[model samples]
Target: MGGATSIKVEVYGYSFDNTDLVARQLQSGMLKDPAFTQVTLSRDEYTPEFQMNFDRTKLALNGLTSTTAATAFSAAMSGSVASYYREDGDEYKIRVRYAPEFRTSVEDLENILVTNAAGQQIRMKDLGEVVETLVPPTIERKDRERLITVTGIVAQGAALSDAVAAANKVISETQMPTGISTVIAGDYEDQQDMFSDLLVLIVLMIIL
Candidate 1:
């Protein structure tokens, strides 16, 4: 029982404009980068369901049914919320999705169920397009342009300043599309502001 005890590494903080680009650069082992023991990239993106609103009337005129379209969508990704199943004295979700083999393509998604008010079945493709795309995660309008931010955490024993510097270099050098720009804002700025305020108070007291 005389083995060395465990060691813990603490990271102070980090700053980054593009978390994904940093991840790729780190993965390529470009800068004696620490092997990220654990990485979690957290960012929100707009899903197809939220971006498009189906026009039921338009579908009906085109011999398409809303029920069929919705059903097809549900069938492909998630089936109607099925009842819960109990196992081992605990309850668990029982989502019924199209078997993986059947739901891989846009064709499969388009072919999903479209039941009519008259109890008729139709194909989703007959009415509208079922396109999956990435819209603005959260539209931020600064001078009338959209923006997205990516953020993540680094493991212990990692130098926060080194990471931030590396991230800034990557951001400045990386090529961005015509309308996109990146910015870094997190705990680092907060700490800097707090310290600056504290310094001002200390200097004022000394002068008095």
Candidate 2:
């Protein structure tokens, strides 16, 4: 089991791409710093997502909506469970989806078919295009601004305050993108909140 974490660091930015870069850099710097044993990115940076872009005018002409086209495209790529089969004492799901040849590339989406209001088959190509791009698997927002978290694990016998102070130094020395900001969160934030509450309780006890 992992030891109780002593602190957490959150590096914020205007966009995920910029924040991710900084988080990685911060993690590398933290490992090299004497104050921390390891600093790891809270989220993976290079998650690939398929984007299907459609022309609204074209869709309207074909009596199709973006929702309709997206639904059709998702069904084709991920497949739909249509039925089931029973074998021996186990039950199996039988699914229907596009063949590998049709689901292999972005161009394969062009072959997708969706029926319009007219009951006519409309090819995806007629609606728009598709592209593969990097997208964040999970989005984190603080004050409605995007941020990335880089968690720093203090070395055994090292003080948590030293790790936090070292991280703050790194943030100060590191150049950031315009409009980007950073804030400490995770375990560190929780620790601060708990201390504040405890201080209040102590002061109340003395007053009583």
The root-mean-square deviation over C-alpha atoms between each candidate and the true structure, in angstroms, is: 8.8, 4.6
**Model 1, 27-96: lDDT tens per residue?**
3332344423333333354445421236676687756556656655765576665779898999977777
At residue 55, candidate 1 shows an lDDT of: 67
Instruction: Please write out the lDDT profile of model 2 over residues 3-113, one tens digit for every residue.
Output: 656566677776777887788777777788887877777676577767789999999999999999998888888887899999898999888889988877777878899
lDDT of all the models against the reference? Answer: 0.51, 0.81
TM-score for all predictions? 0.47, 0.69
Off by over 4 Å in 1: 1-58, 61-68, 87-90, 117-119, 135-195
* Global fold similarity of model 2 (TM-score): 0.69
Candidate 2 off by > 4 Å: 55-71, 79-95, 114-123, 141-146, 185-208
True-vs-predicted CA distance for residue 106, candidate 1, Å: 0.9
Q: Which candidate should be chosen as best, given lDDT against the real structure?
A: 2
